[model samples]
Target: MIEEPKSLRIGPDVGRRPSVEQVAAFQGVPTGFVVDAMFGVGAMCVDISPLDTSNVQVAGPALTAENRPSDILATLGCLRYLKAGDVLIGSAQGWQGCAAAGDRVAGMAKNAGAVAFVTDGPMRDYDGILEVGLPCWCTGLNPGSPFGTGPGQVGTRVMVGGQPVETGDMIVADRDGVVVVPFAKIDDVAARLGAIQDMELELDAEVRKGLVLPDPIAALLDSDKTEVM
Candidate 1:
């Protein structure tokens, strides 16, 4: 039997990932409530944007269909922290039988009540796992896994969907995209992200109104513009 490598082993914070958990715990939330609490709201584009899960469908003799899933243990270690309205998308990573591992994780998310898994890669196993009813996103499908890396330290920071994921991190996904939220300094970072979003939004509105926000950035305009200059 091949022994699991310690280089990228799963730890205790499987359910909420890692960074997400810290944000949730920091915010004094129930962890499960991070979603409703506005966790995954704005992190859409960066989500599946980094993924590529394409050939995830299967074809029978006459009927062709997509393969979905629900493999719980492969997802959250205990799943006690999962709740409804949660989304768990897969991120792309190079590993042995990697697609299958991601598929298994996606299945687990659905079974544990997460909304979906956004993988940039594909899975080899399908058909049987489609009933979990969870959504998935990726580039193509393959039935292999490298499995040497992912989040190593439970409850620590790692990337998912091109964004950092935490244990209590809020995940929101749709056809539009996926996102990980409630950054570190939960109560503070979340507000900061919100402010940034607002600033961007206001900028967009200003552009439409023919009123651009003042460019506060000053450029050093000469080859000798260094501080010494």
Candidate 2:
């Protein structure tokens, strides 16, 4: 493991971000579809989830932070760089025993014009966090506060939930899970997302019409690739 920084390594606010309207169009679309459109391989985070798992979705440009275990100073430092429609993505190292942040920080993010806050660690002040009403995503809940120690990095690529998230990358998250789109790939993926949605809608219409199994499934079921005694 690399030694932690003696002080914060704060970089300039990232300039690249996904098109707002294009990202907003992804609301209510399952993350699985976006992941598939990325060619089944891309910056998809694992394990973390929306704080409100039922009927909540978030999409915005990432503003990343790297936090030490049980410490949030780095996370807090990143707040200075927040912009409207930004999603704060913190690499909490998947620590669950201590809060990644609390309602106070959540409110700060809201005040700073952030669209949401996400981490692979837990957060405290559950009721207050809800009251603040900023969309939050994490592994779970923890009541203990994290230390405000030095040795953190901000505004850089950080690994959270097993994926690399660079500042200004697009983040689309819903009940299914969070997906990160590299800054360079946003337009390319957005270009394909519509076709995926169209296909899914067609399949959905077929299911509603009582058509059982689409052509792909039917073909697979009858193909020589399958055999049974």
Candidate 3:
């Protein structure tokens, strides 16, 4: 038979986090722009959304945790690893029957310097979480409580919302959804963000000026490649 495992596993702290200046670059930036910078990727699954629209936009380094279904030991353990401006991410293997976190947990995260909380599983105590003032994103809410059991890991990589997120990765989220910018790609994504923002602004202006069909689509319709049927 297998031996008993440790009640909780906490990995080493993230050795490299983006500079405050780099993290600030994403503050208040729309999730769409971040996704565009990542070549139309990096978005979390559509189901995970903000607990409230009041505090939707958030950007910070990720502090990741992974827990078994209907359990929250890993999430609780991650608090010790959280740094100021960190975004706490908990992966519950997509379990929705029980909440991965609740109001008290949100309060703890906020006190621990976490700017936001995100999980692939549902949460509880919606009103209390909002009052705690920690921005949160999850699949939904469930009154069911989770156990503080073992078989969980903290301060390591975790898969949240179908995306592989690790400590030190940048997490940018808003009312739209959450997006992850891998730690290795932070500078690269930042470099490309300006160009994407410029292009988006230009397109928005054109659309506001009563432009209907885009140039590419119109050209395709008028060219020999098109056939009327």
> Highest lDDT: which candidate?
3
- Model 2 residue 24 lDDT score: 76
Model-by-model lDDT, in order?
A: 0.41, 0.83, 0.91
Would you list the rank order by lDDT, best first?
A: 3, 2, 1
Q: Please, what is the TM-score per model?
A: 0.46, 0.91, 0.96
Per-residue lDDT over 1-229 for candidate 2, one digit per residue giving the tens place of the 0 to 100 score: 9875577888665555666676676666677788888987653455687887668877888999888888898889878888888999877888888999999999999999998999999988989999999989898898998999857888888888778999878888888788888888877888888899898889889889999778887898899987877
Q: How accurate is candidate 3 locally (lDDT)?
A: 0.91
In candidate 2 the C-alpha lDDT for residue 8 amounts to: 87
Q: Candidate 1: which stretches are off by over 4 Å?
A: 1-73, 76-81, 89-93, 96-98, 101-108, 119-121, 124-133, 137-139, 143-164, 172-184, 211-214, 217-229
Model 1 over residues 180-216: C-alpha lDDT tens digits?
4543335554444444556667877878989734554
- Candidate number achieving the greatest TM-score relative to the actual structure: 3
lDDT of 3 by residue, 1-229 (tens): 9999998887785545789988988988899999999999999999999989764699999988889999999999988878999999989999999999999999999999999999999999988997999999999999999999768998888888989999899999999999999999998998888998999999999999999999999999999999999
